[model samples]
Structures are given as C-alpha cells and as structure tokens.
Target chain A: MSAAPEATWVPRRYRVDAVRPELNDTVSLELAPAAGEAPAFEPGQFNMLYAFGIGEAAISLSGDPADRARLVHTVRAVGPVSRALAGLAVGASVGVRGPFGAGWPMSAARGRDLVLIAGGLGLAPLRPALLRVLADRAHYGRVAVLAGMRTPREVLFRAPLATWQGRTDLEVEVTVDRGDADWSGHVGVVTHLIPQLELDPRKATAFVCGPEVMMRHTAERLLTVGLEPTQLFVSMERNMKCAIGLCGHCQFGSAFVCKDGPVLRFDRIARALAVREL
Target chain B: MPERDAAEARLIEAPALQALIDALTARGYAVRGPRRRGDAIVFDEVARLEDMPRDCTTTQSPGRYRLADAPGAGYFGFSPGADSFKRWLHPPQQTEFRFRREGAAFVPIESAPAGVPRQAFLGIRACEIAAIGVLDRVFLEGPYPDPGYQHHRDGSFLVAVNCASPGRSCFCTSTGTGPRVERGFDLALTELHDSRHRFVVEVGSDRGAELVAQLPGRPAPAAAIAAARAVSARCAAAMPERFDRERVARRLRETPEHPRWAAIAERCLGCANCTTVCPTCFCTTMVDRTDLAGTTATRERHWDSCFTLGFSHLHGGSVRASTAARYRQWITHKLSAWLDQFGMLGCVGCGRCVTWCPAGIDLAAEAAAIGDEPGAPSGSDAHAP
Candidate 1:
C-alpha cells in the first residue's frame, strides 16, 4: 500500500488547545483545528485520533457539537496509541481523521422521557447527548442520569456532574463500584442503580454506554423495569482500525460498529452480542 | 466463417504464449502470471512464456503441498498460492500517509493509493476472478469506498483461465464460482494439451478483441468450441460438491455453540494462515512509525488476520479469548455473516487454506461437520482432499 494516492486515510492536524487530567490514567483533550473549519458531528459520534509516532484510536466527541471552534475527547490510556494520546502536551500537534459513526437519538427521543446511563469512561461519548438533551430540555420529559464510577475519585467531568446535580429540572444520581474511606455514596454496579430509578418506563428512551457485558446486563435490567428492548439504545465499542468500516476489526456480526453504529438500538445487536467471541 | 463477437475462440499454440506476454508488454502492461517460487506456484513478473511453469504439476491436500517436475505438460496446472491479487491491489504494508512535525501540529502529507501498477494479470482462475469481484463489492460498493482499492482495481486488466484440471481440495463447482468463467475477464482461455498443445481463446472485453485481432489465428470452427466446452465440463464433473453452501451459511449463522467448534479447537492453531492465504479476505490493521529523530511519522496499513488476540482487544482485554470462539468467528464470518454483509459468500472455493494449514484442517470437512447432527459422519474424517 506504499502507493499514497488517497486522502481518506490521511489524518488532518488538530492542535491540543487544552488538556485536563481526569481520574487515574485518563485525560480529557480539547482540540482546535489547525486548518479548515472544525468538523461537524452529532452526539455519540467519534473520530480516529492519531498520535504522532504512535497510531490511531477511535475517540468519541465529548465536547458540545454546537461549539464549532473546539473539539473535546476524553481518553483512557489503555493501549499504546491511547497512552500516547493521553500523554500528549498542550499545543502538540495530533492527527485527526473523522467525525464518523452514528450518534445518539436526539430528535427521535423528543417528547419521550430519557434515561442516560454511563459507567466509568463511557460518560465521554454520552456527554454530547447529555448536552443536547439539556439544550432541548423542553422537548423531552424527565431526564434521569445514573452514572457509575469505579470509585468517587474515578468520576470524570466532576464539575459537570456537580452542575448536573444542582439542576432540579433533571434527576442526577452517582454511584461507585468501589469506595474509599472518604467516600459516602451508593456502592454497587451500574445495574443496581436501575431498579431504584422512578421514571415513566413506558415512554422512556434508554441510552447506555459501558462495558458490553454491563450494557447487556443493564439492558436486561431496563427490560425488567418496563422499557421495551427497542426503546433502549447502546453505544458500542470494538477494536476499530478504520473508523470508515473497511478494516473489518469493528464488525459486530452483520453490523459494523464503525459505520452501521457505535450507537445502535439494543434489539438489533442483542443476538450478535450474545454469541460469545463474536 | 461464424460471427466472432468476443466468445469466438482463437487457437494459439502453447509455445506461442510468449506472443500474448509481448502483446500485454507492448501496451505498457506488466505481465504478471503464475510461475514457480520455491515449491509453490505464485504470481510473479513474467517477460516470456518460459518464466511460466510448464513441466511442473502440483499436489495439494490438507496440511500438505508437493510440486514435482512433470515433463512436457501445459503450464498453469496448479491451484492458487497463498498470495492472491490482494497482495498487489491492497498490499501487505502501505503508507497511509507521511506526517511531519509542523511546529505544534503534525501534518499528514499525501502519498497513498498512487503508483498503482498498470498491470495485465495473466492466468487468473475463475475462482480468483470471483474473489476480485467480491472485493470490489466490499471496497467499492461499501458506504465508504476504499481509495487504495479503487485506484488499483480500475487501472488493472484481467486474463482469466478456465481450470482444465481441478485440484484435490477444490470445491469451486459446489460454490458456483466455477471451473469455467462467465464474467469479469478481459480474455478467457481454456488450455487444451491432449493431442496438440493449444489455448482456446475467447475475447471478453473490447481490449481482449484488440489483443486477439493482433494475433495470428483462424476463426475457430464448431469443433474447437465443442472441445473447449468439453474441457471445462470435465473439470466441473471432476470437482466434488463438498458443501451445501446455501444451507451451510444459514445453519452456521443459527447455530453458534455447535460441538463442532469445540472439536476443531483441538486442531486449530489460530495461526491465521487461512485468512492470510484466502483470496477474498480483506481485513487490514494499521501501524505508525516515526524516524529516529521522531520528527516525521508514517501510518502504515498491514494485512491483518482475525486470529490475532489483539484484533479483538477492548479496554480490559480481547473479546475473543478462546481458540474455539476465534475459529467459530472466522468460519461463521466467512460462511454466514459475510452473506449478511455483502450478499455473497466470503470464500470463492479456493483451496489454498487446506494446502497451507499446518494441522491439516480442511474447511470442506469443517463445513460438513457444522450444520449436521451431533454425530452423523460429518466427512471431516473422510479426507476429501
């Protein structure tokens, strides 16, 4: 493939305007386009963030889509590329490839009660949808946010969560999977928080992002609570090499997690997800 | 004389094959045909017909391959090698782009999907042609067409050969891909070496007609057409229908926890050799490299296999950790999921995997094992190869 004839694979340069260290090994990077208009994207959409001398990883857009000047991505240093991306300094140049994949259902969920659930770093992708929902608050009914952190110290977007908690218009609940001596909050898996939620389950649109097993379990729990399987939406993650869907690394059976969805209705992917190792 | 509108056969002596090579070369086309590389037949650059394998025939079975000298036989008498057109069109390692540090930002400069060879691929088999067609559907017909695949594919020419002899592991007849090509060729030929060594040439595209018109040949009489059809028909009958692909795909898709997967796990090494050698497999993994000074970095795409543990890695670890699950994913994707994605079977019935597998794992047998009862003589032990 030495033949460099196409621009699809070439990453556009984006400067790191700001960096905020979050919970252990995670950082939120705020990027501004070094050239051209900032790419337009929706909630739950992601881009292939390329670190020079490393490689590329699919990172979701955590910043407000309305904010055209800045692009934000919250990343955890799990892999080599992610590690390099997390360690990048402000003003450092990074290659950015896309604003690809399906986003959360904002227009579709209008007039319906919404449940936004996140576990650990899964909050990054859902942050956009949360912003969109808050903006169009009058269009929807009760917005319930149930976020689960590994511990109180592991909570991402601490200031935003605290701000969300102050708003009486929405119900924001935070739990921890693990706790420290200073921690005095609910301690359990995210699924445990679902049963305690009191919403119009019949009209609620559930958006979940977390470990696949966690989503699977939470969806089952949501189903038990009266939300239709089709009403539940999931933001799925897989080993993606090409965010455009050609690489075949992000295939979830017939659906390409890169293109067909990073955001998909739970019913469509339930069967494929259950097939172990698929 | 009969109306010769493309399918009309033009006879060329086996020794005069060099004329065909010269014909392509004259048109600024690099002639890449099958030849001997070590012990296997591989596609390589050919200046003359002498470079093609003539006095050599190959034997292929599960986990075994042998090429012996067979004096005075026709050339191109073997199944495909590990390398398919993917090696040339997609490439193993390609520079996606070169990046240079521009102050605070890194600039990814252009250099991809360019310099694609303007090539005439000679001796492409019927199955290989179908594999190319399938790849076209994936790289071109998909939502985001791969620029690298489009540039190389659109510029290349194909010279397909109908298989006069089917290999031991071949099941093309079963898959309906074929011993005879009906589409996607510039020039299609059926080699006949019975009483006299000759090629029954059928001009396919406008380009094929031009090449044939330049050659010395008489209008092929009815007898020549009948003989050519007979050769392809014989080959079709020789290759057995190893699997019911229509039913197998559906069955494999429905049944995920079949005991057959656990059984095959005993023999499967997850070496990913099958995927690498497959004609239709097109997965790619990318890597980035920086120079010693770390000033410039280049993103490179490499041929990736699903068998790698890292291929399925997420935050904690890989989604597919077990060998049985990985094997199931490979076969199920090839047979069933591919149908759901591309509306076609991923396998073109090439037997390269069976011949190259280190543990003698035949896919046909695995196909039979799956979608069958728990124990009903799957033919996995029959040694169809």
Candidate 2:
C-alpha cells in the first residue's frame, strides 16, 4: 500500500495487447501497462487481475520473467471473474495489482537437476519457470518436464511443448488421463512419470504445481524416491481476496498462500496439505 | 491498571469524567463509548458521562447474552459487547474505490474529499485493546500494508478500561491478555465499587497526562491504587479455569484429524456468529457493484467469515464444503495458526465467540477437551511463546 491510490486496492490500468486462445475455456493475455513499462515479475509470482464490473482473480505470470515490455497471464474461465478476464478483447482494459507471493526457487535450483511437474491448467504457472530454466540450459543439469491433463484437448503450450521436446538437454513428458486416437503420449497421472525420470534424487530439486490432491500425490512420490521435502516445492491456491495477505481468505494453516507462498517448500506445508479441506 | 505506578494514578469523580469527554469532543474526536441499546450494551456516540451505560453489567454464557443490573457498579461495569472498535476502524463495508469506464480504459473516481475524522474510543477492554494490536500487525505490518487501516489507526485514540466484572464466558485470564489494561491505551480507567463511585485514571500517554491535568482529579491515594489491583485480581479469580496456551495450540496443530472436531461440527450451525462477534477475526470479502449500464463500478470490502462456503471457494467448488472443515479452519487459525502468522494468538479471550454462538459452542472447552485427550503430544515448543 503505497501513498498513491493506484498502489493500494485501486489497480493500475493495463491494456490487453494480445490474446492467445489455449483451450476453449482458457486463454493467455499479454497486457502492456497503460502507462510506463511493465513491472518485472518472478516465475510462480501472481497478479490479481480485476475485470471492469466483475471481480478479481489471482492469476500467475505465465510469461518469461526476462520479458519487461508486457505482462502475460494465462486465465482459465472457471468462475465469473476469470471468465470476464479471459473473454476480454485484445484492446480492452484490465486491472493488475501484482508480482506478489513467493516465487519458485530458481536460484535455489541452480546447479541442481530439476524436476518440473504440472497438472491441467497448472501448466500455466509452471510455464514461466520452465521458460526460465530453458533460457539458461547450460547453467543446470538434466531437466525433466512432466505434464498431466484430463484430455488431449486440455494440453496447454502445445507449440512450446513441441519445441522443448525437440531439445536433447530437456526431458519433456506429457500424459493425459484419457487419450484420443491422435494422441501418442502416455496415458496416466503425472506421478507415473516420476519413476521413469533419470536423475539423482539427492542432486535434483522438484517443483510441482496443480490441484491440491495432485500436488499431494506428487509430493508423496517425490519423497518416497528420496527427494527430501526441502528439495521439493509446491504452489498452492485458495480464495485470495487480498493477495497481499490482509484478507484471510488464502490462509492454509499459518501460511497465507498469497504471501508466505504460492510457492512453498514441501516440508513446511506437508502437514497442512494432508489435512482435509484446510 | 495492568502496568502503572501508584504515584502516577489519578482519582477522578463523575464531573471530571464528563469534563474528559467534553474535552475530547472539543478536540474534534468522535467520542464513542458503551451505551445500552435494545437488550445489549453497544457502542454509540457519547456526548456526556450520562450517555454511557450506568449501573450495568452483562451476564454472558454460551449462546446467551443479557444486560444485568449491578447495584454499585459504575459506567464501566460491563464486559465488552458483540460490537468492537473494529466496526469503527475497519468498517464492515468500506468503499475501496470507485471506477468509471471511459471508452476502453477505466478511470478511478476520487472518493470523499475529506479525510476520516479522528476518533477517541472510550471504555475499550484490555482484551479488545490487545485485539487492536493484533489487527495492527495484520493491516499495518504486512508486506503490502493497507493504507485505509493505517490511516484509521493513526488518527484514532484508545482509552482502555480495566475489567472489574468478568463474565461467565470471558477467558482473558486464561489467555493472559486482560483483567487489567496494559500497554496499548492512552488512558486506562478502573471503576472503584468501594465507598465512592469514582474512577482510578492511569495516564498512559502524553495526551492522557495533558487531559488529566486539565480535568478535576486528585492524585490517587495508596488505598485507591490498591483497590484497582484488588479489582483486577478478584476479576481474574472469578473467571473460568485457565488452560495452558501452548498445550492447546500444539494439540490443535497436531490433531487435525481429531474426532473432537466432528463432534463439535455436529452441534455447530455454521452461522458464523462467533466470527461476527470476534474483535480480531479480520477476514473480509470484496463486493463489487455496478450500475445497470455497467459503466460505473464500486468495490466495497465487507466482513466475511470462514464459516461461509464462499470464503474458501475455488474454481471447481468450495475447498471446505463440510461444516467440520470450516469449524476446524476457524478454530485452528484463531488458536494455533495465528501464532505462526502474527507471533500471537488471534483470540484475545473476549468470549464474544462463546457467548454469541447460536450452537452454544465453547471453544475454550472444546480446546481443553482436545488438549486433554490421551496421547496428545505435550510440549512448550508450540507456535505460541
């Protein structure tokens, strides 16, 4: 909350420069600040996107962190707020309040092999981290990107997935719960790909982002294979009214998912994540 | 009364009390104090000492609250009611900002031109004062501190009142937050029910000392100071049994799957009365309103409770769908998780939650039941100090 009204609850104006449809219900919006250059954001950090007459939804930055001209957010229209945001025209106005919450341990994962997993639209948040890692390919060791979707149609970043799969430095695995006739990928949960990944558990760090249950199962598998809880991180989501943590909507135990995390060490939240409906 | 020297205390009679209110009113502060409204003691504007509730105290228990007559008790006889100073500071519904759509962009409409008026809260109980401190950490000390809260907090003055009459449901004694005013007030008053109907005023700030100097008050005698301490001691002694704060917090964190929650949920109505009456429960939801043409919009933040299914709603559905889970979230967050969030328990032991619960749910009793369960790990290494 700065002295300026725009910094508080009043959001800064952002114009939609581009809109790329991912799925029937999901789209990626590239927003350039209505005024100065866009603010820099870290991978896994999110913004509270406000629609004109509707409300705000917490959407993660899905663009490359190094990109400074525009902010990109991938929104899946599951509620009124997200629907209003996702259906906006390219030239329409939107409200943005972020670069909030703790980001993925990019610096912590440096010099260590990485295991990045996503489930459903969960790929949207992980996109920035994946892009960051790919940009610095030589700075890290073996990189594994495993994705799980309900169906082949829900697969996001199809073009980038293809580009990453063509690279020899990265391991990209896509799995769908139910595959179509044209689908050539594995059909199972994302946790199934964990056992097949070829990396030393001690030297590797993992970042898992998905629905609650999926993150839990992925964490369990990662731990069983000897990836210490500190070596694995998960991004959590809840109803976030005040993304700055004043509104208690996003509190999961002591951690206000908006501030203390969106990305949290597995060990810190392992006990809380197991508690049903917390 | 909680932390003050006898030499610094002042004994003020009814005339001096009225003079203090008048002086604050002259200073452009909206002096708010407890007054009897309907069947409850609620806060309202106080123009004089008589405007406050007199010879009144409250009888409170689980699911019940009633105004009772205390023969010799003075204006500050009652324990805190459902409404707290939070209703004045962080109002239930406050307009965050208004916006008007002009072509493709939305422009923010300026709110009221004038700033919020300074406020002087009179008769704030010790627990309620502690609750304000908790809210300060919440809205003032966060990474992105709320400007509205900061403005209200900075412009406000606190006048704490030491508790001489402890309600049946009150547990400030157990929480170690009350029975006497401590460090957070400008002026603290302890009503002496002994011989004369007077107040023992303890000046806490320069403003308090200035006001006391102006008012007609004599230096408090040793007997008067002793009486104030005796009042607090008697109040604490009369309250319910005390439970170890660390033990209760640890039990709640360790036993997320405890059967006690389900049992409590069966009786819990999910009405959210407890949170509504709670002073430190600061969760809120944004209500966005727009005209029929959808050209203008206003976003208002309203008090929201964890009991509501919508409070935890996500894309698919609500995260905490069951009554059991919502209750668990509220209790765990208040008692255990708050320590991890703000380094103090969210509850001030004001007991509004217990007295106002429609289901007659006593959280202290429930916490004790869980803490007393066999094999529940016991340690002082919990989140609380």
Best by TM-score, which number? 2
Clashing pairs in 1: A1-B94, A3-B112, A3-B113, A4-B111, A4-B112, A5-B112, A5-B113, A5-B114
What's the residue-level lDDT of A210 in candidate 1? 87
Question: Poorest 10 consecutive residues of model 2 chain A by lDDT?
Answer: A1-10
Docking class of 2: medium
**lDDT of each residue in B106-186, candidate 2, tens digit only:** 898986634877899999999989999899888888777887777777757788888987888899977879878878888
Q: Is the docking of candidate 1 incorrect, acceptable, medium or high quality?
A: acceptable
Highest lDDT against the true fold, candidate:
2
RMSD in angstroms, candidate 2?
Answer: 3.1
Model 1, A1-69: lDDT tens per residue? 322344588777888999999878999999989877798899999999998878999999999988999
The CA lDDT of each predicted structure is 0.84, 0.87
Q: Candidate 1 local accuracy as lDDT?
A: 0.84
